[model samples]
Target: MRSRLHSPTVRLRRLAAELRRHREANGWSVSETAGRLGWRSPKVSKIENGESRRLSADDLDKLLNLYGVEERGEREALHRLAKEATVQGWWANYRDAFGSRALPDFETEASAIRTYEALVVPGLLQTPEYAEAVFKGAGLTDDAVSIRRLVQARMERQHILFRPPAPHLWAVIDEAALRRVIGGREVMRDQLQHLVNMAGHHNVDLQVLPFSSGSHPALSGDFTLLEFQDPLDQSIVYVDTASDVRFLEKPDEIERYSLIFGRLQGHALSAAESPVYIRDIMAGLESDDRE
Candidate 1:
């Protein structure tokens, strides 16, 4: 399990949540649990909160024992999860390119992804050249190696599209994103073409939220809603900011984002008409080139 290429971020979080629930169920406070286990309060807090960078199977065993989880099946299942939690995804090597395992980890287990981008193309749909321009433009780093690694990491995240039972991806991109020529005309052209091609995939739904639609929801910034296949896993909103990655998991927050995405989908072009909209933009770019 540790040898697997993908990070078990979801599994780790699930285990943490489960441990926290068990502890709370027994009426043991964090400090009480730590005192019983002869560990620091922060140590217990970190592991229970899924903030631990590395979790030991031994520690998990101790936790299971403390929580009075006796059933063989239940204990074994959790033990297996704890073991998988130690495994790191391929992106672990490119920490500079991508900070923290948050996004990649959530993406690993997401069964459906809803994205709304106002300023630029979604990373999954971006061409290599376009990705390079985005990375440089964002001022991530001037170093060539870091930029290359970042682009490669972004490209690798698209593999989920081809995986068996590919996750359903519905992307609502602003009209401005389609019109903006990033990395010059050739790059923008290729990027738009790729989006058109990807739209045809059975699991992919692409929409263009035209400028003519006027103002609507999601003016704050870009965000992604990740839904998991498992009922135990909670759906989450990933807010991507210039400085930090924020995750919203509260019931109200999830409902709010879900409604916003639905509204965006309603206002955007239909799946069938999106390609037409894109082709028109492509032609406009061509006319500018000719002039």
Candidate 2:
């Protein structure tokens, strides 16, 4: 589970899932839970969907009991999981300092990540200079030291690429991201090389939507579609904007995003051509005196 390795979000998701299962077992609609528990219909959803503003251990206990799971040991195990799940991970420390949100997931288990980025190099593959330049453009410039630390943190998170039980990552980037000279030519060169190196990894599928491709579904905006291992269960669409992040999980919403991604794949170059594309960009960057 992603929560096991990244954040407490996993446990919260399980809590919601457990509640849902019990409600189904008892043959109760969400309205039934609301009626009996003196909650509004949305409250039932908040708790069962794990979108509650706060995690109440007492509430979880009540739901568990209402579900009629008689085993004390099982209840305790889930309770403990919920408690841990409520705790913050390392990224939480950066909340006030960074204000960057939704870097990880808490619910809707996603076994694979399909990412599309256009303007800048995605955090997973940024060189330090490129990272700083991209952030500076966003007005995140504060202390150079803090900026460097943040960059290091992002690089560390890249370990996920090689971790055990790794998620299959399909990263589709645009040619403009490569052609754009971020942090001057030097940083762009290093960035291109990193892309080449990362593409060699078996777990990663890197493809470039070359500028030659006239238009594609992902052209409107960039979003990631995360697919879980299970069926009709955990899946989400993550869309990041300058000021807010949105997570979409409805079946229709996910289907639309999936279709968009499928169309993008059809227009983009294959993974096998990724390295060649990178090298071509690198050569162009090197010729510039600024590099």
Q: Count the backbone clashes (under 3 Å) in each candidate.
A: 1, 1
Write out the backbone clash pairs for model 2: 9-106
lDDT of 2 at 195: 89
- Least accurate stretch of 10 residues (summed lDDT) in model 1? 1-10
Please name the candidate that would achieve the greatest lDDT relative to the true structure. Answer: 1
- Model 2, span 77-105: residue lDDT tens: 77876776766666565464435444554
lDDT of 1 at 118: 98
**Residue-wise C-alpha lDDT for candidate 1, range 42-75, written one tens digit per residue:** 9999987778857777887888898899999988
Computed on alpha carbons, the lDDT of every model, listed in order, comes to 0.87, 0.76
lDDT of 2 at 21: 86
